[model samples]
Target: MALAHILIVEDDAEISGPLERFLRINGLATTAIASAEDAASVLASDEIDLVLLDLMLPGEDGLALCRRLSAANGPRIIMLTALSEPTDRVVGLELGADDYICKPFDLRELLARIRAVLRRPLPAQGRPRQTEAAYRFSGFAFFPQRRFLRSPAGLRVPLTGAEADLLLAFCQHPREVLSRDTLISLTRGEGFAIAVRSVDILVSRLRRKLANDDLAAEIIRTVRSDGYVFQPRVLAE
Candidate 1:
């Protein structure tokens, strides 16, 4: 496999230089930028796989940079901030950072986060692709390559970002009673610290989109305390 290219957007030379060397020695390519302006220049090149962005920069704040990066569809970002506040972390996640690490963090943990973000499967956004080890269940069809989910009557369902992730988890492990905590971990990214009630809200929204007015129990049956299950036979594609 090709080495993952990482970009470090940190103004502090003391921090940026060491992190760059650490990652470089670990079979990864690295680029270090001191400001958001320079980082934006790097992003326009479209070559980076992951970004390690600092929250406090000189000119534009890290939060603003993150928002611009999200808007421009730049590479995946993992925030590196000195702020230890939970609100700062939550805001970073909401702004689309894949993970957040406070300053004075271990290098190993940072590397692990980088690997985890790189390992996540890409979402389907175009024409469908086929996969043999695939399944059809709960009124949805799974094509791994395409990441496509077609309804039972052959209607194409357009899932939002969160909905696609939650549905992917359900289809992957059908019939298993996944608890609210488990579901949240599977669907919500690691940085998400939302209430468990959010899962119910997601389920309700997904159900309305999938069922229209038909509200059938067989489609994502909720177990009293065990959570929910994808109650359909999954055909391997």
Candidate 2:
């Protein structure tokens, strides 16, 4: 396997310099840019496997950039923020970041996160059968390969990366109640340190997106003390 290419988007040279040197020394290809404006150009020119994005930037903030890049399916984003609040982390995840690390973090931990995110299989890759690429559930079509969701009326619904992962997990195991921990593991992989509350937030977001008057029945039903279940029948194709 080729070494994963990392793009470090940080304004502070003191941080970006060491980060670049450490990742390169650890056998990964890296490119460091100070401003978010330069980010578009670099991403356009290179096949960046992952991005270490700083939350605070000169023009466009990391959250905004994450939203934009994620919509384009450009690269896997791991937000780097000085804010340690749980809400901050949740916001980052909701904005489509694959993962996040608070600033003043250990280099080893960051490296581990990078490897973990890279190890998580992307929707477009590693599927043995092409038929598994799309899933149909209750008039909703989920195309995992393209990370797209189409409503019953043939309208396109935008989904974040985390939302897509969670919805895919539900579609794959419809009518089965998945515990919070199990859902986290299935969507984020093992060793990811995400709170169970985050799962609730994700579920709420998905429910809102999947809601409509025509589809009055709840597609995802809460199991009281347990996690939740995809109530609708799903056909994988």
Candidate 3:
């Protein structure tokens, strides 16, 4: 298999240097850029599988760059920010980032997120037949290949990488109540004990995006002791 190319877009030499070196040591091809413009140039020239984007750039901000990248076909982005606020993370997710990592992070944690993102089977590369290309569940249509969701009202719902992975995990095993430990291990591609709150956070975000704010049980339902379940009748396409 070809080495996955990664682009590191950060103005801080301290952060970017370590990131580049670590990725290289792990068998990934990496290009580090000091500014958003340089990052864009690298993106235009390379086949980057993933991007590590700093929120505070010299010229164009990370949010603006994220929007621009999302508008076109681009690499999966993992936003790097000093901001640890939930709102900040949610905003990044809404803007199409695959994941977000706060500053003063562990290299191992970042590697876990990278592995999780890469583990997602891209439909363009052809996935297993057991996993459907598209699924219709209740009034929501899920296209795993595109990481998209459509409501009954025909409005499109955006999904972050983590959200998509969680949903896909559940959909792949419908009606089964997955344990929190199993969820963390499976969805994250790491056995590290992540806060169960993170799973709750992703579920909450998906529920809101799916218009299940009232807790109507439109799609996902949380069990008291077990875990969450994809409640809709799923039809494979």
Candidate 4:
């Protein structure tokens, strides 16, 4: 399973705070929001897996947000509220909610529902939208899913996980010099200990891969005394 990030859109502090903590403790990332407006902003800027929404929210209600979010291929929505009325559940379902659970619900059951919803197919939508998809640049495409590079002629080139990881960092921050320390922190945790020279070596291997057919000069450039910069503007596909 992918690293799941949950967006909690509940007005109640008592509900949102503990729910966020609990989900985080169970190895999931979370963003807590109190209003539908903030939730919309988060959805646009971040990749969310499932949204845990409270029906009775301040300002625009959860049903409204669910309709707006679910109109296209988007994250899975699971409505949460104290309202157990049949009509409320029906309306929420009609608005494209994947599941609905009454508030004051058990955490275990809630987690199970989240996992179930993530496991099922999103109908014709295929996989949930991810922030890191294929990064295309200078007639080369890098697919993180299969850890392979596609040449301009559509030839498959293999990539090591380490190479792919560093390539992703460069793609994310193109045309900017990234210090060796910064690249280490982006690819590995803060605690990981590797010399700065090793980072240069890794960059060399990846540089050779991008230098396919002897065009590596246009792919990555080294800024003397600084770090490296991805010379191409990447297009995500």
Best by TM-score: 2
**Residue 135 in candidate 3, Cα distance off native in Å:** 1.7
- All candidates: TM-score: 0.67, 0.91, 0.81, 0.52
Model 2 misses residue 149 by how many Å?
0.7
The local lDDT score (0 to 100) that residue 113 gets in candidate 2 is 82
- Greater lDDT among 2 and 4 belongs to 2
If both were scored by TM-score, which would come out higher, candidate 1 or candidate 3? 3
Q: Where's the lowest-lDDT run of ten residues in candidate 1? A: 123-132
Please state the error at residue 9 of candidate 3 in Å.
Answer: 0.2
Clash total of candidate 1: 1
In candidate 3, what residue range of length 10 has the lowest lDDT sum? 122-131
lDDT of 2 at 52: 97
As for model 3, its CA RMSD to the true structure in angstroms is 3.6
How do these models rank on lDDT, best leading? 2, 3, 4, 1
Write one digit per residue (lDDT tens) for candidate 4, span 83-172: 988667767765667667897988977887777656543322345656546889888888665456798888876554456667888988
Clashing pairs in 2: none
Candidate 2 lDDT over residue span 94-211, tens digit each: 8899888998999998988888777765655323655557899889999976678999999999887778888989998999999999998888778777779889999999999999
Model 4 alpha-carbon miss at residue 13, Å:
0.7
| Residue range 107-208, candidate 1, lDDT tens digits | 998887777667666543332744445667655675543345587778866543345567778877778898888877786546545567657766765666
